[model samples]
Target: MALGWKLVVDAGDPHRQAAFWAEALGYQIEDNSTLIERLLAAGTVEQSLCVEFQGRLFWRDAAAVRHPDDPFDPVSGTGLGRRLLFNRVPEPKAGKNRLHVDVHADRGQRDATVARLRAHGATLVRHVKEPGGEWSVLTDPEGNEFCVS
Candidate 1:
């Protein structure tokens, strides 16, 4: 059997990170209302356990997005592949990201990708070019660096 993994980000505001990353990756936010409602009806979760995000009920402090065709568990709304999971952390992001994602656009679409990423709140930190190829290093609003090539 194949195994799946989620790239979990520790952030002061997990929902905000999820929102940013969802747009950055063109992924859909996972909706967990069914489970939330079930838990509330069963008295397992408090009435205040669910929070409204963008006018929709969602579990506070955590959210995820996945590839459009990926499988998800109906009960928990957990994704099975190409997932990014954002969880709450008390501390703010500082320094540099030792591990970051690299996105590859079409052969000649790097510049367009950079523009789109910047529109999504990423800033171009630097650009690199060589005999081999070219790429742009960018940082998200929270200062996490990623590469586009």
Candidate 2:
């Protein structure tokens, strides 16, 4: 059987990170409110760990986005494929990312994609060009590095 996984990122503001990544990747934000409500009602989870977002309860320390067409659990709102999870951290991001995501745009659309991402709060870091390829390095709203190619 194939192993399943989701990319996780650390962020100071997990919900904002989820929102930006969802828009960037054409993904849907996972609700998870039903599960949270159930946990709260049963006293299985602390009420302090939840917050209302868009009038729905969400875990205060994490948020996620999943591919629109991916299969997800309706009860927990967790995606079964192509997902990214952002978890809250007390400290701000520092130094470079050991692993970073690369956003591959449709042919010849990299620059346009980068521009759109910038408009959505990404910071243009620098452009790279080598014999092998070219791409733009950018930082997300929370300063995590990613590339557009």
Q: Pick the candidate with the highest TM-score.
A: 2
* Candidate 2: residue 145 lDDT (0-100): 93
> What is each predicted model's overall lDDT from 0 to 1?
0.83, 0.94
- For model 1, how does the per-residue alpha-carbon lDDT over 1-149 read when each residue is reduced to its tens digit? 97767898887766777787888788878888788888888999887656788767777778888877888888878787789988877888888888999988889999999999899789999999999989999987777899999
TM-score of each: 0.90, 0.94
Compared with the true structure, the alpha-carbon lDDT of candidate 2 equals 0.94
Model 2 per-residue lDDT tens digits across residues 1-149: 98989999989999989989998988999999999999999999999999887678889999999999989999899999999999998998889899999999999999999999999999999999999999999999999999999
